[model samples]
Target: MLDGLIISIDAMGGDDAPDVVIKGLEYFLKTTGKQRKARFLLHGDQAAINTLLAKAPLTKARSEIRHSDSSIEMDAKPSQALRRGKGSSMWNAIQSVKSGEAEIVVSAGNTGALMAMSMMILKRKQGVQRPALAASWPNEGGTSVVLDVGANVDADAGQLTEFAVLGEAFYRALYKTDRPRVSLLNVGTEDQKGNAVIKAAHERLSESQLGLNYIGYVEGSDISLGGAEVIVTDGFTGNIALKTAEGTAKLVGRYMKDALQGSWWSKFTAFLNMRALLALKKRIDPSGFNGAVFLGLNGVVIKSHGGTDAKGYANAVNIAIGLAESDFLQTIDVTLEALHDEDDNIGFIK
Candidate 1:
């Protein structure tokens, strides 16, 4: 039940603040089938949250409010947010996870701030070189986990290898796909293609006895080709790839809308193909894919797009819910232990 999966929410985060946060929970619990199994701990200004809670009775029914006198602004830098973070809603929400009151934490707040606070409060998992932000990307084979979307801007070979392990954990936990294929995003599919760091990381991955189905290397274009279920790279490169994909999707959508609306004939044809188009639209909708998981952290924390609305925030909440409900963190921990053991075995075999 959802009560067993307590989600701590930062009600004062995001552009829409408590309004969207509360409404999003209501929309999700009311429309979604698993409403009865869910519970929430909302953190923010008591007056404001209560005002909205009155309107979102369903969410209120399943939630307990925790008030905070302060809040970090949307424009504050991560460092600034950290300095002013005490007793803030975001801080309190994360504190709930740390205190064991909530299994997961969700915030549509500043990404940098959220990550910084998470690392500080929840701390990093042992042997995790760096935390990675992973998102589910729509691909031909289905949704694939793409990591380092924005956690660390730079990474060495060892750090990149760590990301692969984290990526594998996410794919296994969420998708439950046995032996998920992993890949390194590079300039080309060729083994020799990329910087020294990537090449070095590729070598380790290829030789890894960690049970990863490493597929050598995949180019940027290969990301959506369904060749790999998990793509690992430095945060700098991954962030660009993610933004590029988002921009391209938007550009294509705009062009299509213009083309379909330009002429009466086009409109008639659009109407004829409306059902198919809507299905495709639903499958690739941005709102449906709003959440990104912060991998390699000790506790579950989901970062939602700061500008997202209720439905988008709900999607983000769903990601936090999913990870909390699954053996995600446990899977990563277990995989790391097994990886170390396998490396020893591989060495002995050699």
Candidate 2:
């Protein structure tokens, strides 16, 4: 078996905290049947967790509890929480990962709070200017990794290029892509089109010796079509693109359902097409793409949707475990170091 993978979960993080989080843990343990190898550090009220466990006992006794009486509110300023809420569940969970008690940390808490706590506790990797939130979105061919999903809203071209390098390393480690294609999200596909920042980033990415297949610029529509395996952008644009895609998917799904049920003949056709529809749904299910990994952090930190349900929360925890077991962070560090060295050598040669 892979080395022990400990996932630190903020039991009081999400909208349906404690209950949903507990249920998710139970579900994962029962379904995976590897509860012994995969353990959890549930950070919250010991009494509350014990009460829940008593009602619904876990099969494995590997799970541990770290008591935290307080919870950081979703709206609370992340910096303030990092400074003041040291005893909160979110802080404690990240701390466990930072201290090496846990290999990965998963939280369905305040995104800002988790990001802040991770930056403060685990710290950024060497040579990383800023940590970024990287998430995978389902596409036609496969999943695509989008970096700075909500981490650094204001980023320069150099930072965007760094994101590209980080993303390429992540995909290489996890997805095993030979040379991951990296693209900068832009309004137009042309190399000369976009603001000064985009043009500068395009030039840097084109000229950089990162060994990635920098595929020029890609538009928002390319996201769903798998235009590039790794797409890099500032958090502001990335967030807007991600939310727009999600909303469009929802709208299309609803519209199709409504149109199909409008008449008896259409309803009959819908019944006939149910299998195909289900297949499409499975392809685009958000739960399958739940966790947003915080790359460039010293420790693995997964940010789940604040409104995630039991299944969604469980998926995030599972992702964290898989990433830790896969040793993605260490592999990313090594790959980035090699890229940096190559870049430095080229500079020296010139």
Candidate 3:
């Protein structure tokens, strides 16, 4: 039976599928600590998921299994998965969103396959030349929205402007921010530093009366310095920056751990400052922002980290719920129509 808000889940898509998925759902229900009326349509191998659900009373109560023996592999190519992914857990989860059986879909499956299937199934929202993936980035001020993070490797001027639109709406939806500052990522903040595509996109944003807080260009260092609330770029550059930041966080964590345990004095100081250390850890933890959204889609789909724990998965689920409850899609549609109208007036779309 359908309940309050239905979330479709690819239960067998993650690295620790079924087990982690069930535990994550349980954590989401328990931690919310309110009268949440959310239910789940879990698509996966019923036998495996049932075994886990037997232990997770909260999740079992809220989730229903849509049995599918097949699942997409972590390393499977998008093309291959597309050819043979029918009836798979990932496929069914997306299908639920397409068929209006669920408000949103969550998957920790192969990114390529997930994006491919989402595009094929849900298609693109009107006025969108191409869809972009947006990620929640932890920064000095707070979380910033960065796109197109590995969705479209190369975006032209028009597509880059579209990313700005998509990212602005996304930042608002996720963080409840009003009038998020949008900026283009480039080598330098100066107008002449970027290539032709970047310059063209910048010109368009600056001239458009789309009501965006279109700030100028921001460099890599500015990303963590809260240079702008929404940083827009091509997927090639954005993906590299994302990976580099992730790796650097891990490296810093390792270094901190080593220094904290190097000697008795270090250990004593670490113990004495345990509270601050934990606060710092929580601030930098990637799991706190685990959901990557494939924006500009007809339906909402969240891509959770494959290796994330229960906490990370819960964060993703929370994002899905928040979007489901908001008028995010309508806002996007209205803004996109404005952008298209403006573009058409100046022959920008041509």
Top TM-score hit: 3
> Please, what's the RMSD in Å of model 2?
3.0
> What are the per-residue Cα lDDT tens digits for candidate 2 across 77-107?
9878877889999999998888888888888
Compared with the true structure, model 1 gives a TM-score of 0.94
Judged by whole-model lDDT over C-alpha atoms, candidate 3 comes out at 0.91
| Model 3 TM-score on a 0 to 1 scale | 0.98
The superposed Cα distance between candidate 1 and the true structure at residue 347, in angstroms, equals 9.5
Q: How would you encode candidate 3's per-residue C-alpha lDDT over 127-176 as one tens digit per residue?
A: 89888988888888888788999988899999999999989988898789
For model 2, the run of ten residues with the poorest summed lDDT: 341-350
* Candidate number that wins on TM-score, 2 or 3: 3
Clashes of each: 4, 0, 0
Point out the higher-scoring one by lDDT: 2 or 3.
3
TM-score per candidate, chains pooled: 0.94, 0.91, 0.98
Tens-digit lDDT track of model 1 for 1-350: 24567999999999988788888888788665255476899999999999899998888778898989998888889999899898999999999999988999999888899999999999999878679999888888787778899898899987888889999888878777888899999888887699989888888778876778999888787676677999998899999998898888889888988998899999999999999989978876788888899988889888888888788888888777777778888878988777657546655221
The lDDT per prediction is: 0.85, 0.82, 0.91
Model 1 stretches with alpha carbons more than 4 Å out: 1-3, 33-36, 340-350
Clashing residue pairs in candidate 3, if any?
Answer: none
